[model samples]
Target chain A: MLPTSKSCILCETEARKIYAAIFGGEIPLAVLNRFVVATQRLNANVPPAETDAYYRALLACDDLEALEVAARYTRKLPLLTRKFRLMAYLAETVPETQDFFINDRSNLLAGLWAAFTGGLRTAVKLPAGLWLLRRCAHV
Target chain B: MSELIIVGSGAAGAAAALALADLGLRPLLLDVGHTDPGAGPRVEGNLYDYRRRHDTFGLYIGEDLHGLSDVLTGETGIAKLNAPNAAFVVQDAARLSPVEASGFDAIQSFALGGLGNAWGAGLYRFVDADLAGFPLRAADLAPYFDRLTGEVGISGAGDDLTPFFGATAGLQPPLRLSYNADRFYRSYAHRRAAFLAQGIQVGRPRLGVLSQPRDGRPGCDYSNTEFWQDAPYLYTPAVTLRKLIAAGQIDYRPGVLVRSWTETAAGVVVDATDAATGAALRFEGRTLLLAAGAIGTSKIVLRSFRDYDTALGLLENPAVQIPFVLPASIGRRLDAQAFGLTQLNLVWESPDHGRLQGSLLELTSPMRAEFFMRFPLAARANLALVRSLLPAMLLMQLFYPGAAQPPAQLSLREDGTLRIRGHENAISVRELAPLLGLMRSAGLWTAPMLIFKPATGHAIHYAGTLPMTESPARYQCDPTGKLAGAEHVYIADSASFTALPAKNMSFGMMANAMRIAEAAARR
Candidate 1:
């Protein structure tokens, strides 16, 4: 089904905002368009009410807070879970942003630090994130 | 009418047709041949390099996002089926040949090469012990295996696996292992004596992949795109079928889906459908060979007899996936060129569980997105961690011999779809502990919690629905692969395999098919 212009604009705006929050950069128009298309396709499978709720939740979060809230919701309910498959789909299509995160020229010290901080941050936020996801998404 | 008719153009059909051609017989091969649309555009360099420069989500994950659809839909196992380019391998499988499965996660292929189109190309020969359940011994199929080894360019070294995989002539040099696998192999080599003492043997895997140019197909250039696209150097049964058709040895008819057959007074009459048009068609032949895979063949046979009540026992190797890491190899730069197929064969002789086999593979070929969604951390954190750990990660897919208890059953439903009821074939953690300890000693570390045992039928090494028996029963095939109660029909696939061993069965399936074809031709 062709995406409606109103829905497409909302998807584009949210995708750009989310991409910026997660990766801290201007989302390329090409990447943003791809994300919007993929998100809409994934949303087609989800219930309209749930899709609307998910978008409202994303809209409520400001800047990097969206990443935390999305991560918390995703961690408790996996992105591939029936309720959150669209979240995973969005993450998957934004390869341009994810590519920037891979440190191909691996530095052992840098890697260890990233892993340590990542693991610590995940542990610290997991409990509150779970509670926040339940309150925010009502899932 | 042709002298011989072969159903399906998979491993068995291809081998049967080739062997018949050797006897100066041309078989008419009917198939619902699904093929890749085309390799749209080739990736110029290695997968990593290409991905770094371009947005490869469409290429790797698929424009339709089919690569991740399985995971999204909560379908576990069958990772190969999710490949974007290889989707055609399973393109009309479910809709065309519907199956009602319970607990059994079954997958079938109607593609030109069948499942071999997306196979890992592990081509090990089964020894006599592996064939103990069959009426025929390893010697009975050795010549066919040797012939196939030469015909389908194999690459492997004669090592610790030589005893398990019988020595076959004409093997090209083995593909070079990736950095992580290479380090693991060296560690295993150093502790070989100790590991062997514990009944664990590690060696280079025999693969149906060319290391040298042969038959106009280029040798493997180690682009590490083996999982993403069709490689010319890899051996698929379709390659043999194409050669046979081009050489006027087999009249290959695509788009014909054989549903069933009946043995007539004079010959055999086959009933099929024009896949595209859904028109009923019939063909007659002097002899018929059913090689539509174990499940596919069983469905046809059950429908032919109109036996919806009778349930046939199904055989499939129970599999477990263990993802391990080498701490020392972490933070190492990824290799630009490396063979992404099975790098090492790990054989464990468990006194309680029989022989268990595992293929140790490097994790560089598949797209990182496949794993990104599954990691426990936040998206950015998970991405960073995966990037760091990917260079060191290796996956070992361990397979156990098929069991009889709480048996998996395959039966035809009244509605013409095949029904499969499967049971959990659980492997005890204690049985694998020794092997894990041995690997840990070699610096390969993995956690018990990280082990993933996919549901039954995930291995895709299905067989034994219409097994070969010395004393043939109503649904059984005789020692010569002749279907019981039928005069001119023969089973030329894994359906006639009496036992399912832990070793990969594609090579053995082809060899056994050739043996059955030769015997049928002589008769």
Candidate 2:
């Protein structure tokens, strides 16, 4: 059985492969790990109900852009557009690892989403959205 | 004559009237009741006495009084308050209130000011993050919010100048913080330094109360007395219409009860009966706004469900109130933000006391919500035995998201009065412990929170119905707040909300409402 046709709720793509190879995908691992760590920090203060969603989004998204885009579908339905914008600044603010490949698969992961968003928009995002979405959870 | 006939004279009705008046549209406004400002029930005689024929509280409890031809036939009207029998039927109905299977709560207020009249005036804005996913931003909503604030005048501070403002913030100047509120923030700020450290805003409470007269409203007295009926600074819709009537811009048709409507290509011919005469009049308007509160508006929409398939969805106040005991203050402390909801747990330090912790983090001294708590009394004594301690109950409301499914049938009897009933997922004590703890630690619980249990009493923040969908087929209204089947008709109140956030949703909706109106007007 073709494991059920699914479309990324954001991108609205029906199992369409993302052109991560050409347009680029995934955040640097250091930043991805940083988001993972920050997501942990976010949980310490907020309600567990809210924390779990935030943590899950950070773990799944490969980059900040994808994560922020994922937030467009998360249950809490938080607005993370600014957080997505902030990721660029955040990346520029921090030092990067020399061995990092910007499009590394290790950096790629699934992120959270607002329930109402559609297929492709929810899926096939870059680290820019993911990085911001992860940071917004700390908010 | 432009032939504008406004339906209710509450916040939205009055605001619309005033806004229209400013726009040079002097349409006739009709209310079922009339009153004089600053008059202690001594102002005037009923200009149009629908009294004998009108349902006494038709608008008050219209959503629940399902089968009543008595009021119209002069068989029944207002119920006596003091007499146990006056509202006894309603009480009994409360006993048999339906579970959430029906998917909505049926609440209506007939008080003169409409729902906004009874509002606690806790004004706050939707966070920028609240608006992040959507295409619209603060700049897009600037004009409408500016006009609303210029006309209505809200009072607020923190969310104001923080570049963090979404289009929904700064609707009006913010309200002043209460004594208890000032104390609560000072304590709670220190407890949660980690979150507050990230430049995350702890709100400066805002409210619809005016600090100074703008558009003729008086500054708040801080008395908070209108807890029941009429008082200044209450900011109920009644006050606006009542004042506008004095200005000769709006007229009183206080007891006019809407019977039904016939859908027409142009619009609807709303059949209504005069409360005093029992006579029928079919009023016409090119435009109509149902700014009636959640249940009332939804009830009317449900009444007209045949015209629109998506009419029945109610952005339910899947209201949850969590009560928690503050590790710091425990029981003796009480506090909140401007609009009766302390949405933020602000932590700050007191000038006098020096403690190790810099920011006084709160969400510590949670409340004993009357509804959530089960203070086990000596077996056999119902909660009534110790009703004096009702104020002791607390609840920090967790404004959850969910919509009440629209009722399949919303029918009104010959008298133009109807009744509806509904509830939510009632969690067990253990399940509610954390929520209760949250409230207690946060100190946002209300007195009703202490009684046997409260169910959505003040979960008044409305939304989750009439959402904007990418597919026009899936939505009742677009993100712009226009109902799908009908053009030139839109929802300006909380009913336009599809996703209910934690903050007060009115500011957000009004901003959208104004934008929709502006767009519609341009068209």
Candidate 3:
């Protein structure tokens, strides 16, 4: 029934405080339930603002190892941003052999550059279901 | 008539042109390359290959005369070898050989804008350590920094050098961090304080891009792979040349290369040859400034004073590259380039969350090796190999490679020409350019050395040959940027650089050139 049940490779576990901290301040009320469901799928159903704060905290506090650990549990791209294109790019393409996270890394930025630059052109036809892509590293 | 006659059109030469324009005295600005006055984007080499993902990696096995290029031997030596089809003024010139021991300024750049066309727009200034043995200070260059930022339009954040000098010349609101950059963010913005324990400081890159745009230049589109190819995004000096021409400050002379300059008691006279027709024309001036780049200006000096300065050897400097892998998880985080300094990360840990002194905050992006995967490689047997393994090349340059290069020598051959030998992980320019690429070297044989081992060198960070210093052992220019030996010659280039070139040498070089012109104008 959940997205992670199908695509996620990492083990799904109960969400930590960091999860709630990453989805900080901004989330439309209509999509809040969808975000809650996606996280519930990852068992990371913390509050949105907490998720964002945690993301920032990770930037200010955690090292790469901790960041990786957090990444593994993150099952879905935040539905609020509709960064599904980034996610699809990752899943469709084979991850790199050497740099473990490169596929995720490339797709994330390339997708963002594309989405951000193409913001005014065609937001309607976009995938991942969000006006702006976030959380998901899909290219 | 003049003190020095500089040749070539590029960063070095353009800086000279700008410097002279400020002085109110018009120095002879002749270009031998493509000096046509055409409007609109005129991209060479990049236009055809713009959209394609091509890896410019490889080796050129040939005989070269001057010790300028790095394609043949990684080392710089005066040896001649197999030549290109026909070395014309542009891509199609008459076949020519160099005269043995002929002091010729066989420098690059004949275009109206010089080498500024192919720049990536990464600008940085030297710190105290970068200055090292040099006898110059940030205060001395204060005004030039002011003048250049006013003219060139640099973008980015940080206290590296620009902030201290002050002004938001061309920075837009600040570019957004790509989601990909989070991997290297820690190593970048949130770097470990341990480096401070080791005296290492990681910061963001301060570049010359507008978060917003100004000076008639448009905002960055960010669609192109490299900024150099960002036709509509960047505002190169050629753009500035048009403005200068409109202002009636810059005169136009396409196809004219100053063959030589002879200074007499009255003034200086420059001899130029129409690169296309070989027809010689002359220009005279009260003062002269050398804008030919490091190897360029020095070669010009070599041509000017055959035995004037014995310190012209490229051997005097050896730029070193010190690279290291960021802590595991940090690699991805720090490798991401956002609106901050992705060019150079000044890493130093703070007592709290370590702060980065760079221009952009790392977000995420494809690595060089990984990005190169987009191109076709003969080595790859299948689509799987190319598709799967390409985008993982995020390597941080611990310190810019070629940290110190001895005064390199670009000899003028019998018939008249020159060459160089070099690569990048740090600058841009192809003097002995278009050398072997990093990805190619990384892909083939590197002895398993990390990116640091075979550190890269780009012509972007220009320096040495004619360093500006008060002492003979220190530099060749005065505090005001005048060449020490010559009466009226001044260098407004990296050659006048007494320190290791900073992240944005163009801005620095531009500023330095302005300073030299300011002084010359006063005289």
Using lDDT as the measure, the top candidate is 1
lDDT of 2 at B301: 59
lDDT of 3 by residue, A1-139 (tens): 2335454322122122222222222333322323233443323444555445434433343222223323322423332211221111122122222222233343434433433433332222232222212332322
Worst 10 residues of 2 chain B by lDDT: B352-361
Per-residue lDDT of candidate 1, residues B1-523 (tens digit) = 7788999988999999989998898889999999999754457767766766666666666767676676445556566778788889998887889999998878889999899999998898888999988999888989998999988999999889899988946899988888888899999999999999999999989999998999899888889888878899999999999888899988999999998888878788999999989999999998889999999999999999989899999999988889898988766666658888788999988887688899998777776655654556765666666678767789999998886335589999888888999987677666678888989999899988778888888888899988899999898999889999899999999999888888999999999999999988887
Q: Give the winner by TM-score: 1 or 3.
A: 1
lDDT of each: 0.80, 0.40, 0.41
TM-score of chain A of each: 0.66, 0.32, 0.20
Candidate with best TM-score = 1
| Model-by-model DockQ, in order | 0.38, 0.01, 0.01
- Give lDDT tens digits, candidate 3, residues B1-523: 3333445456555665666677665555555555332222322333113212221111111122111122112232111111111112123322322322222213244455555654546555544444556677665666666665566666665433333324544444545444333444433334333343443443345555665667566665443223212344454566666665677765655667555567767666776667668787887776677676665566566666654334444322122222222222221222222322254444322222222122322212222222221222211111122223322223343223234333334455434554443322222323111111221222211112322223223223446666666764433777677777666666766777665533445666766666676777677
Q: TM-scores for all candidates?
A: 0.94, 0.53, 0.57
The pairs that clash in candidate 1 are: none
lDDT of 2 by residue, B190-289 (tens): 5444434422234554556666666655665443222323334435555556666787775556666554445566655666767558788777666665
Best by DockQ: 1
Docking class of 3: incorrect
What is the i-RMS of every prediction?
3.5, 30.1, 19.9
Q: Give me the displacement of residue B153 in model 2, in angstroms.
A: 3.2
RMSD of 3: 19.0
